[model samples]
Target: MPWSLHGGSHLPGCPGIMEEVDKILIRSLRLSGTEIPDEVQSIREFTTELIVESVVRCLRVINPSVGAGLSHILPPGMSARFRIGMSLAQACQDLGYQGEVGYQTFLYSSEPEIRRLLLFLVEKLPRDASEDASQPVGKSTTLHRAIAVAIKEQLAVPWVPPACRTPRLQLLQGSCLLKRFQAQPLVLPWESNLVPGKVPPERKEFFVKFLPPVSAQLPQTTSLVPSLLERNMAELSAAQDWESEWKSQGLGSRMTPEEYRQWKLQRLQRRLLDQLRQASPSLGPAQPGTTGRDLIQLLGSFGAGHERAGALAKGSRFTHTQNLAYKQEAEHPVQVETIPISRTSEQELREKQAAELETLEGELGRLVGQIGDLEGQMATLGLTLTQVEGEVRQRQLGVTEQEQTLRVKGRTVELLPDAENNMAKLQVVVESSAQRIIQLAAQWEKHRVPLTQEFRELKALHNSKELESSRRLLEIRELHERIRSAADEAKHKEDLYKQLLVELESLPKDVSRSAYTQRILEIVGNIRKQKEEITKILSDTRGLQKEINGLTGKLDRTFAVTDELVFKDAKRDEAVRKAYKYLAALHENCSQLIQTIEDTGTILREIRDLEEQIESETSKKTLSNLERILSDYRAMKQENTALLGRTRET
Candidate 1:
């Protein structure tokens, strides 16, 4: 019904561009011009193409280098199409002939237009020009003729051209003003001579209620005069007959003698009934809707109308049915609702598990790596110890040879390996040094037992932690899997809840499904959140387990140093040993303290996360949402609170 086509031409360049897009849109849309008459469609297309073609034509005309523009003097009696073409050309030339076209050889040639504006004007117009430049010809005559033809053809009427005569408009000056008045017609009671007959007693009483109070009797006046009285008497007689014509007692409710007589008959009937009751008294029982019944029953019988009366006449009573029959026929109504969940819960669980598992495995691996490092250091220490032992053995063997040498030649040098008896002294010194080394090695061996024991204990602790961590990791993983499964199921239920929500949201206004859906959604959301939090705890537990395992490894390495303490050089190594022992003790204590802090921090964070989950899970939007979902789920249709004990025990 709305015409959207932009028929006026502001179309630029080739019309082909718009034509192409239009064709595509038209074809794609499968739009039909069936609603438009063939003539209008043809006209629309023709105008559109004409406008487009005209633009092209104007552009061709304006591009000329020397000739005057064709639009300068549009032909007299030109068609609208031709005029439109001329305007198009002039517009293309950018409001032609505005300021100046200076004779510049550099810009444009100065050759005058072969068909100049003056020549074209004189040729096109049906007027003669005056010598004075301002003197005018009848400029609008040609345009007027064209307009006359267009108006005649388009409007299908004889073209009555606008009058050229100078016209004046004035208000008519006169005193003929409309007076404000009301027309009152005296409608005489006897005007139409519709003198109505007396209404029956029953209808009169039925139609007119609230009878007038009884009034005291009144007297009439006497007449005077003789001949005047005689003439007056005849006139009075005529007037009395006329007065009967005008009289109307039907509009008034003052009872006539007949109506009064009927009312008195009704009272007489009531008194007769009472007298009969007193005399005989043993009557049949009264019935409803009979004359004996009260007015209210009569009205009520009519109020029920014919349908109920007919039903009662038919004797189709609604008697009690068997309890089993009632139960069998009664409807069993059931409602099913679902819960909602986050879409990414499954993926989140997986990601958490992945990261925590990586951390756990990484820590265990790192402990293994640390053990390798400790082994490397121990290997180097062992190699150097073996070298020291070898050198000490070689020197000790040389000392024995020297002692043998010293026994033969030096008693004094043999005593303490002094330099005096060189070989003997060297032998004794070598023996002493070897003995010190051996004793120290023995002490080192003694210390190695406890150190090894400590290391074994630490390793056992590490193994225990690792086993427990691994078990916990398995549990965490299983929990993750379970949570993932639960989460997925939760999501499934949640999706169902969302679907229910969408259905509920789409339900008719009066349906109870929305409240049911909202309640279910809240429950689902809480469960999903709880699942997510549980998954997170599993993730955190794995990571903390890894930290404990790492601490165990560190403890093992620290205890290992105690093995190096006991040696022949115990006195010399006392400070070094104590230092090592103190360092281990300090590291172990720090590890335990840090582990506890980190564990507690992790726990608190988890608790806070859970609390947030709880808050989010409970969507306390409106009072109804809260009451229907949480505070009182079963409450129905109540805007205000009910008595407390009225809640269902279930």
Candidate 2:
């Protein structure tokens, strides 16, 4: 048997394995007088080294002597650096790995490859050690090898934890790891040769000879290692010694490999129960009703108890049928009771009829309201008809009174001939005025003819006088030219006389002064006679022009009077024509008035006949209609009574 490490059972698994390995290393290092101030850091360093060494070992297993496989262990993009002299952390870090933390993470990695690698190391390392020691390896006298083989075959294919593997495989793997605690000569480097196997020579072997001899009996069965029968027998024998070592209490000899496995499983169960208790401390004893049932349930969980019937209390009220019903209730938590289809349909028909009845009742209410409104309207129409009848009678009385007044007016109208005579006398007076107007017009025409003739003669005379005045003006202009020429001649003669006097003064005593003086006096007398004659002619022409202007004014006045008389005669003729047109219009209007009177008499006779026919028709139709309305009203009342009875019955 291998010496067990202290606190090995208390430690859990993978991480616990790491911690145990670490403690061994620290103890060894401390024994060598190497003080580690921070033990955890030192342990991390050692674990990193172990991980790197394991990788190298795995690589060597692929191919010894470091061939192309060595490169496979390097991080993908790592340089081909020398790892021989380098620390594991430094080498791993240089390879782009996270050194110690990465090694721990990889050890617990969920990757199938990492898991396989770790298991492979655990399996190979101890077997290799046993081989080196020249000891029997894997030759145990037990059935574990077959079981381990079956488990390995079942878990041959890699799978994610808790999802793919069967519970049996999980239990086997767990048991196998627990079994590793008994491994001889611990496989970790720090633990090698540290645990001594034999007692020291200086110590007395007090219990060695007293210990029981080992048994050479083969297992009773080839199929089972530590079957339940053997385990129970061992437990019974061990019951007498409470303080005996659990390992030593085994039946076969001491704790056989099979008994050790059984004890370990029990211990694991105990740990689970303790943990469950810690998680829920209020887990009390089973209730009275469930205690016996729970005992049966517990017994049923045992593999061998499946064929046996449950044990029950003698006075218990439970039965197989009731248990089956309870089981069914548990399976289907909510129960739904079903009803018959006929009942359901009847309920639905009742609901539909109720809804229709409610609708009919509402319609009846509306009809009643409408009937009340119609009755009120009929009352109003009746009152209005009576009022109209009274008004018509009053109008008839007023029309009769007006007709009497019209008869009185007709007698007065019979005296219109006297007024006609008066009108005829007025007409004679108008005729006489017309004749007088005609006579006056003729006299005015005669008077206008002479004036027109006189105006024509005066116009002719005025034209001749205008021509004579123009001729006289031409003669006066000629006289003015002659006078101007004579004056110029006289001025020339005076200038000649002055020059002659100047010559007379410049001449000798022989120059003729008397001749020059005689010439000057003759010229002066001639100038005076010419000027006086021109003045007389000019005065005579001006007098003739003034007389001609006076005659033109007189002629204009005469023509204006003739124009006024002619305009008055035209206006009077227009006024007489207009008066004749008015007389013709009056005669035509009188003829139309006689025709209108005849038409009015015919229309009034037709209106009286139509009114008599309308009264006869109205009297007949009103009596028939009133009889029909009374019959309809009585029928409607009977129908309403019948409907009310039907509604009440429903």
Candidate 3:
């Protein structure tokens, strides 16, 4: 049987299923803790909103084009709510729901139906909706996702008044960027060079200094295409420069492109600051006690006098040395003195060089050994560090588990004293629940027996009625076929009659056609007389039928009054009881008789209708036509067979 709100036994797992459905719906709808009640039974105004929003969201996920523009909330007005409910019902049906669905199913929904519908909708939701975010995505998709996240975050922030907002903070606020750009007058290179020749001085001054911003000059509804285009072009140019720099120099730099760019920006800022400082006036003159001279000037001043004294001393010393050298040369001029020189042998020199080479080689070997030992120690340290890290992670995990256990144990300890009382309460609840279940089962049994009997009785009645209807339908179809056959026969007979008349006309002028005409008139007259008789008979039958109906009703009324009066007397008197019995028997006999008469009348009507059909068919000469058609068909068949035989022989 189809499911009904008032009927059907609840499944044992239905509550659990409903809970799961509620969780999925709550999560998907993003309902806050306070927006909806903890229990489904407590839902009121929010129920309609939740259901509508969830259905719309699921529909959109399933088929965006079809679900587009569907309202996510129920309307306040009764008619509109009804319309929305009807639409949602239709949409669900269109999605191929097998359950019985109507506007009432949504607007006046019960818990079970709501749970079923929500479960179906959740199942219909796109699989990709709950896909893992950790799944790989393309650069474009990732970029778009990031952009969406940024925009969402920006939108989530409360709006600040324009007056209190900073430019950076208000980047995503309204059309601030466009308004900012519009507030500035667009200055072109050519326009900057334009001289005001024909303008008045006052007008020129106003144009230069007091002109309103571009936004004021333009209409409020004016398009920002030009400004946007300019901005995009500027961005594009900067992007091109960045790309070029990154490829040419940034890649080879020790820093990343971003870091390199930052460094360049810092250098540019420093240069700008230096330029600004030079352009500005000095703070004050140098102090009187302090020299303004740089290191170069101070060093030059100290070295100048020292260099002159050294030159003069060198000149005086040179003269004295020359005189002394002259005296020494005069004394030593006559002596050809020869000094003896001692030189080491070639073998001794080679031995000393070899000894030094051996010492240097030994030192190089010692350093190589030390370097190898250090490398081994470094490798050992790295292995030890990795082991230590693993141990630390394990300890951290253990600590976390211990903390969780401790927390659970602490709660258990807190509840230790009340455990017995809780257990007693729980036992009482369980006993009460068991008793309630038994009571419910007994009540259900009480209702079920009567309902089941009634259902079976109704089913039997329905089956009998259905069979009667089918029989009547068959009779109707048979009558229709007979009528159609009669019509066709009539048409054919009319055509044959016309053809016969035409043949008679084409006959010789001397041929007697008066007798045929007279016969046709006589036949028509007889048919008219028969029709008149049939009509009179039908009128008489209708009169009899009305009288019978009136008599039947009168008899039923008399029987009811007589029985009421006799039943009272029958209780006290034996003869009256016998009389009452007789009266009841008479009434039953009369009712049966009436029924027989009605059945007879019905049969008579059907017989009359059959007779009329037969008469029509007879008048149309249907039998003769059929015989003629059969004869022609046989002749055709014989001719075809003869033709086939001749062909086969050939």
Per-model C-alpha RMSD: 65.5, 79.6, 41.0
The models' CA-based lDDT, in order, is 0.45, 0.50, 0.62
In candidate 2, the residue pairs with backbone N, CA or C atoms under 3 Å apart (3 or more residues apart, or in different chains) clash, namely: none
TM-score of each: 0.15, 0.13, 0.23
Least accurate stretch of 10 residues (summed lDDT) in model 3?
1-10
lDDT of 1 by residue, 1-650 (tens): 01112321122232343343233222211111112223332221322233223223323333444223333232322233345444443543362433222211101111122112212222222221111112222325435655877766646633332442222111112223333232222222121222247546664564455343212111111211223345445657876664343233311324554564456556665555455433322233234434334323333434433344221222211221232234433543223222234644667667766886786567556555665565567557756766897799899999999998888677754555545677676789899999999999999999999999999999999999878866775675577568768988988667656544544454356534355446445544654676698899999989989998897798677666654543333557777767766766786798799779989999999998888656534422234334434433333224223434466432
Top candidate (lDDT): 3
Q: How far is 522's C-alpha from truth in model 1 (Å)?
A: 5.6
lDDT of 1 at 147: 89
Please say which candidate is ahead in TM-score: 2 or 3.
3
Candidate 1 vs. truth: CA RMSD?
Answer: 65.5
lDDT of 1: 0.45
**Model 2 lDDT, full chain set:** 0.50
The 10-residue segment of model 2 with minimum total lDDT is 180-189
